[model samples]
Target chain A: MVSAMICLLKMPCAVVCSKIAKRGGAAWISTLAYSLAVYAGAPDVDQIFSARWAAGIDDGRSQLFELGWRPEARWRFNDGGRLTGRLRLRVQTESGTRPGNIENDSFAPATRPQTIGETGELDLRELYYERPLDDWYLTIGKQQVVWGKADGLKVLDVVNPQSFREFILEDFEQSRIPLWTFNAERSIDDWLGGDWTLQLLWIPDQTYHALPKQNATYAFSSPRLAPQPPPGVSALIRSSEKPDRLFADSDAGMRLSGFVSGWDVSINYLYQYDNRPALHQRFISGATPLVEITPRYHRMHVLGGTFSHAIGDWVIRGELGYFSGRYFLSNASQAQDGVASSPELSVVIGLDWSGVEDMFISVQWFESWLSDYRQGFTRPERDNSLSLLTRRYFWNDTLQAELLWIANTHDNDGLLRPSLSYELEDNLEVRAGLDIFYGKRAGLFGQFDNNDRFYISLRYGL
Target chain B: MKIQQLFGMGVLLMLICEAVWSTPLPDADEIARRINARDEGVAVARSLTMRLTDRRGKTRTRETRAFRKYYGKEKRTVIFYLKPANVRNTAFLTWDYPQADKDDDQWLYLPAMRKVRRISASDRGDYFLGTDLTYEDIKLETRVSMNDYRRKTTGEDEVDGHHCYLLESIPVDEDTARELGYGRVEQCVDSEIWMVRRSRFWDIKGKPLKTSYFRDIRKVQGIWTQHRIEVENHKSGHRTLFLFRDVDYEHGVSDDLFTQNALRRGL
Candidate 1:
């Protein structure tokens, strides 16, 4: 059994190495080292199968059930090189106990592909190769890049577009969609005097955020629409246009980071297309009202900076970003043909404290301000939000209890998550949590108030 | 005339005795410095396995590969976890400075997060991965300076048939003691090799808290090292055993392995 397991584990590495060698450019020595490291460090196989069921508090009959499986492998080579691959498959089933029919749900189409008893779609979660040169490191292929230190906020962490199929119910790690890119970093500490590094990224694959399909679970009501006109009316048809696959369509970014005077600081700039589509509407000359809506991507420039400093037993962190030429949906009263462009600023500041034994607390305040405010924009001119996370460990750190609260001070909407996790063994863990939402139906969190649920999951690794 | 000559001899004898007694023994700080200097090397690598036993007798094991190298006056050490699928590829890097006042720079790379995070220096007091050892205990092997500790030679003791010097160390202030979570510590150091064979820790209330024993003493590459260490927490019926294997000294380790990027790369 052990030998079979070992052979099963080695098959993937052997296959990957042979393919790389056949393609050439990869050193044999490095390949051997990589394989050896994989054999030494990697487990024979790591598989996790989990099941979760949640029900709405207001209507107990409204329920959601999900089953998921994930398998992953990692390999490391000499000179700080690594390769990782992971696959995820999940199936979800939901029962609509609310007043609306499931067929009329806006998000139903998105969840239909992975509905109950259906063959769930397979997702390549990660497939990347990382290599470190003398003073520079390079990573290529599809991967996720995290750039900010803020908790529960996206100030400078806009590298990868997100999947909102489950709204904010999923972890960030699972929700982030990876993009194919060439990422490189070089150390400049020798000249900069501190632990300085510069990173460059070029993403060729122009991926967009995966929003929930109309009539699917967790779908929110939105004003943007591309309605199909009735056959009798003469309407000009315009289809959604996606950016072409070319070098010019690629996104580029740069970041410079360093540590100085006990502070970790970074500054970054990115030029990319907005993942979401901007609506362009046109009217046809006819007695009957007829309109055509087309979705298109717009360009944007983002400049951001982040810093974290330790003060005694507390860690203070902050992130700030300025976005130029961001598109916003026009108000209903406006007869605009397309979306409006605006500049915006966002900031987040937080502190983490562990003063009390076995307990940790983190608090953050975030704000976004529109530089030039007008009456025809979808969002408000200014918005403020706050988040707090408290965690306590028991049973020699094997059991943990956490409470997370995020509140939009402007909208008076909020979400509260209370979770408990227990490590049953070295390779097994169980977690249970409650996701509760409160306030106005139009607010971000308040819209999910009817979707409030309690869920439990069990995961075993190895 | 005979009585006068005898009195002169007695006075000379008294002067000789005073001259011999005036030479002082080495102070506590000097002893600590000597202990720190005993195991100096260019670079070292080791694979270690740790077994943790909880109060209910449940056990968990973890394995790691560790490398350490010295660059001028600074020391850099990096450790990577190599076992248990959940924590595989997790790495930690630390750079220790010669200056006692300067805090050590530390970073942790979590594979799940795919990022390197700068950790606070105050985390030294936290238990290391549910083990009975703290990050401070690992650093105490090379950091024996008495800048923040008041040390005294309590007398002599024996461990496993080897004669050892018993020393008591107390934090310089109450605040420092509270931060370290220890009121006092007693260490039994092997007199000849200057390696600590055993240590006893006391809580803030001066109650016995934990005891650690260093066993299986062996010499590798001219450095006396303890191949096994067992630490038991008295307050909680829990203990941990650390077993060192494949120890190598004078290994050619690259400076890049100590960097934050290297840590994230799992080098």
Candidate 2:
């Protein structure tokens, strides 16, 4: 009996038992095999299966109104696989007319709105399948994979392109564009006397960066992210060109992560097309000079790594990336292409401390340097940014207060967010917050100074 | 026949008297060591349901699946939250070592972020997942920390029909007391099973903080297991209850489940 049980453990006993029955095997053998299979392949019947639904409404002082709902479902299979999905619906209305915007979806098809509505959109946010096969774990479908340790910033975490519809005011999970990807991971126990994991990713989704629509509340009017023509120079902006072939233009990456000597580290590499479009220009002179700007997507390479370690209530994390084939907007008169290609390096280091009773604090420093310096690029050769985040919980962790500040040192501009949330119940919450921007008109956050607003939101989940 | 029966009864009574008087009870340190080195299964998997009741009498519930395994002298544990939409798929992993001088490595994985974050273990005194029990309390459930306290046998007591030895433990130093947020702790250990049946804690300022009760203990797969634990905060009028079920000691959980990669992949 013990030997038979061991044999049943080696293979799917049901299949073996069926084959034996077809061959007229002994009755007891078939009965034993089938019984063991039934016991081994049974799912966890005691587990709770639930669907989550959340409804929320937000009202802002700037007359920005949004009512949203999300429904999420999860399923587990007897074969140790899982399926998860989420759908989001939102209705947005703005009382004031915004200025300066591009045509909706001027870049890629994925940027187009999903539903046919002027003020409402129903979208499928996420759908994924996760399965464990032998030693490898696989997740396939539309999802987001974060690859960095920096908070409120990006260094090596560029796997998914982002939507600037709210201009960095929304959480990255809400703004990040999910892509169809095949992810696989496996762990090695005795590699160099350390625990390590190797992860591989193949993303065939051809979605590009998304920009806000015209007359939207957070449309861009700045010179850096949006177009700003010079004096008396008429500019014709052409639609962006993107790769349409599926697997031929896919992005691939590999990451090897491990824990060694109390430090968690990962080395990552990715080859993919840049999320942002590069402006290629043609200058037409004589009788009214016209500069034709043609937006095109280019491929790039990224190599980076992340490391983190904790010591006595403090965690220090850092990420560094070396990017090749990076393109930037330029106005130099060299050959009049309006774009320059250069190698770039970016790094971010952050520290999180939780020594205070119920308070948590984090500070980060970020920098990006263009190795091949050009004189007339839109940005400086080296750019620096800093961020600070503080959060505290009160009343037995039912009330939370948080503040996040991100500043561009070179542009002397920053965004400040302060928020408070109280849990009215286990599944209900009320929150109020302010989104404030300050500094130079041509800078990042400064351009959004006109959009400063206070907002309140309530959410109930079931 | 009556004479023979009387003689036999007298012999049995004398034997019982000899057994009771000749055996010496173990000292406090020996009892502590026995509690720390109790024969818990090498690997265990169980389902846990935690309910937290606030001062206003409002209650919130959370469900999870927990797994633990011993690797030589070190221990590793991983927990996955199973219910409640806000915290679903969130997981915590800890790699604990036997040495008191070495800090355990801890990691947290948030499904929304899709990232594994390393967190400091020094703040174990903080409440865990908003429950009345602190992280230290949960970590020390299966084993006791023998190095941190000076223990002495206080007295004897009866709890739920079991004879228990009462013990008083004082922090070895002011720093240790501050770190654990405990000035002193009193425990009731079941004399027969050598399990801690009840514990009372005092804050650093020597004020009553909370009490925990372990109940419904049973032997499964030849290992003693606690099926229910309740903690009540005296000052806050708050309480937390943990009920464990479907415990298996022969699950043979994979070693990979304790790593960061497995943490990101929900069970």
Candidate 3:
């Protein structure tokens, strides 16, 4: 439906722009702009440009966008069978790590706008078919599984592996868990009742988006390396390995999730995961940098759950998980323990004062443990974290506002960030925010090393 | 004859039992009509004051106002901030009752950088006028249906003067649960005029959490209005009073008032 509306809007522009050709320059510019609009709306084909017709999803942090028939409908249902399919193509250009220039190599800066990179991705993001019974549902296909429960600012997105770091879709980001397997779910009226979802998927090679000096992918320029048999095998070397490629393969895995305790407790678990190292680990291990949240190990398993209870005006929520298998780090992905003896577990808790009509204050804390953090970053940001936020309104409906405080690694390394927003009208909004960090700060922790910058954004949606 | 008579006796007994158990529904249709009748078409300017006492008894005060109107298929609501720094001047336009479940089309205009922007549904729970009420709350009647409206056992104990109808508002969906954050909201509106008097909200598991009172009911242009609404946190003792002052019904609010252009016009 969204796509059809877009196309209808384009047809008139094409005819009108072509008719004004005799007007010369003005007509040409109109034609160019019209073409750009079409290109932007053509995310379906992953054209050079795509439209920002998001109507946008305004999350607490940012406004993200999307559009239609989209991700695609590969299947339909009939008397005995159902069909479905999806093709997703995306292209992204983002700047990552800063202070990488010859001037600032060893010393990490507060914020650097130099981490720029690009990716052209094409995949059948979802293809599935389901046969449903009055009491049960069975679905089988290549699907994406999202096992996220925490209203997390970091970590705990342990479902299907993707670019776990950097800018990716947030909402609906945890909507899919797919694989090439059949699953069934049941609904019943009893003391305790909920749907039990089960599935299997061949996990895809993992990758990350724009995070400067972060991620596991490695990029290098030294022409000489081992496993090459010297100069004589240089010709065959072309078939051996590349400097920018990560050694990771997606494996077939299974997933199970459902709600228990009368639609309150959400349980999510996954096992037999094909752990692929990130680009960095692949690079360090191979002679290449991996992409995104690539694992160092080859095989691993994960299990997790989240629960929430309303205690008076306070809503308490928590999530926890365990991961075991290959753990890798670095640009060249290396391998960690091949067994469950050394597993990583993470837990988080949040309390919200939700009784008030328009204002609220919420606080959350997180702790992650990976005994053998392969190349485990001891950085405050890569470790434990906590955050508190408060928001209120004033003087009628003229102003809307918010305030946030984040403390990581026991405030020994963290940020004291505050932001304010004002609404001009329905279509325009302006925001300005500041970040104050103490102790040691890097990555998303600090934007410019010891310095701070004001961040601002203005958006208008039709 | 003997068997037939005996069967008739059994049927009569069952009828009497059924009559006793079945709740006697009152003029519920009349009650629903009254509940939906208020502000049917009104241009209202409301002044609101919010006082919050945190877990530690520290109090913070915030004041604001909302200009509202109801037209054919549109309910235009605009909010303006009245006090506190940083948010000294801000506005949001919402077009409710469009096509979906009281969906609110919201936009905020910021003077700091001079811009206007829209907010999403997920973020609706964030904040509104810097108070505990979310955008979800502003959109009323989230399936608040009348069960059985009956006269209270002690109606003669009038708080003001007129007799009030005690009504139970049972939410039928998650939106209401998330908004009210309560199991049920019991209310009292004047029986004669249907102007709300007071209400108490409870959680799904039946935990008393919050109480609110909408008093000073008056008729403005034949429309009964509750000029004052006070919401109190049962557990914290903090409260916010929303007062409707200088209210006018059917004043014909312009469509232009809901745009970014007018929002920048400011107070």
Candidate 4:
């Protein structure tokens, strides 16, 4: 919540100070997108975040919204199947000054007046219609989909990017978008020795679909991702939990993602030449451990492929590719440089262990270098990061022990850091960590003054 | 005799019956009877790691976990997949023996798509990772109710100080193409532990397709567990080896854990 305020206060200020009418539809968009980010995979509880709170060990609106994964029951009398209803309501306050806690629900209005020191809004992340088939299932309306495995910061959750930014900057609170989507999947044949699954996604809205734009700073919208005031400005540190910049010109488009041979791959081609003329040109970013500027982009091509293999307790995984042609980037200004991005390459390699069944741990090293970090094909020498992360799981499915340590550079800077997380329960967790920096992209998270951070979150399935 | 003595005598009856271990060169009748009487039942979770060799035979590995809880009248299972991704999955199934529905309610929660789906009545011969283990293999609705075991051969083996049975037997059922799940299922059981040492399967066309070898057998709560299990897909030329460290059973299972609620709980 504090992070979102920092972002609100730091917003280009132009938008926030603009005549109310000038805000346009962007307001509502960012608003809906704000709080839903917490629940995208609220039920899966795949990583360190959703703990004690989600599994019902604790029941609070924010914790449930962040970690809760509720169920709606169904029974079929005939072959047609049964109808079921599932709904989640999370309550939270905006400015904290808002009385009665009405502003707390996931459905609370984004731009509430006199809300208090709070610069954010309560959100209703997902409310969709679900139609289940024997072998095929569909969820329409507002929903979240994770195309890739590695989540928590959109490194490769290609299917959907729940808004982690709105929580950072109140300006985007109303502009956030949840991809109105339809998903279908079936286990086809096991022809090649591995079970083959065919899945289809129909997105009514692409707000959640990742539409990477270049030249624009990847503002986490929260304190950490957003640029901080030059040291002396304030004594308080600001940061957002998993911040990444995104520009989803959600007119109408769909992305198809799948996997084969240890690699997680996707080919997202959204074109609306007649409507949003600007987005007609494809925009691509190196989608890996979070989007980084990539030299490869084509107004015509957009693609990303990642592969990670765990061989006898050792995992080796990473992604590679290129995009070419006139691509999209920072509101059309940076692209004026003739070439939008560095037209470079990105990759991350990680390894883990499985020798022990009850206990497992993993470490991954990520690298993303732009062949033209200096600019269009100019400087051939490339640069990225060489970071390492570790995650471990404890007994049954209750506790998770995780650590993240990254070494090397982002853009052209050195990053040395560590993140620690302890599983309080299946749905709630408390985390504290820090990043040390020594270069450009080092303003926050890895910025000055130790850059330490602490967070506590809980989830409840409605 | 007092009830206490009767209970103890019943156990003694079972152990003394271990004399059946002596290879009597029993006829098909005696062999079938002896083999079917093995075990206090066990639950298994097998993790299969695949290395897909392309047309050029270059290999790439992907990992997946198959969890199975097998008992008297039924067996329930769930499979979680990782990598070679389109197939990354979570499937729940219950196979009841001597039950009306035959195959229990089955639900698959896919992590990739993030949806739990129900599978209607499916055919048994369906493929299992491109191997002989078919959709029927996962569902134990059909058991060796009636079989004629012809000991084609025997070998001496020891696992954890227990004598093992490595005998070859051909199943009796045929004409089972679309309806039945297994064309043929071969077996090898440990004498003392009663743990299945190895098993093989052939497709309906009578072609050997997949094989599972169990090792590291140990007794847990009066039940035998094979700490290690390996399933090889012959057609795909790939194999998945599962290493089990801590194996516990019937500790405290809340019925709710098996409900649709748990599915959404992402348990």
Tens digits of per-residue lDDT for model 1, A276-349: 66667676765777767666777899999999877667888899999887766665446376467778899999
Local accuracy of candidate 2 as per-residue lDDT tens digits, B52-137 = 89989998888999999999979899999977766777998999888888999999998767788888887787777778887778
Compared with the true structure, what per-residue lDDT tens digits does model 4 show for residues A45-76? 12211222111112222211222233332222
Which residue window of length 10 is worst by lDDT in model 3 chain A? A219-228
What digit string (tens of lDDT, one per residue) describes model 3 on residues A60-83? 322222221123332233453454
Instruction: For residues B46-79, write the lDDT of model 3, one tens digit per residue.
Output: 5655554444454455556667776775677787
Check candidate 2 and list the clashing pairs: none
Selected candidate, larger TM-score, 2 vs 4: 2
| Top of the candidates by lDDT | 2
Question: What's candidate 2's DockQ score?
Answer: 0.31
Q: Fnat of each prediction? A: 0.33, 0.49, 0.06, 0.01
Task: Highest DockQ: give the candidate number.
Answer: 1
**Candidate with better lDDT, 1 vs 4:** 1
Interface RMSD of each: 1.8, 3.7, 14.3, 17.7
TM-scores for chain B, in order? 0.88, 0.90, 0.71, 0.62
Please list the residue runs of candidate 2 whose C-alpha ends up more than 4 Å from where it truly belongs after superposition.
A1-63, A95-113, A190-193, A232-236, A281-292, B1-25
Q: Residue A348's C-alpha lDDT in candidate 1?
A: 97
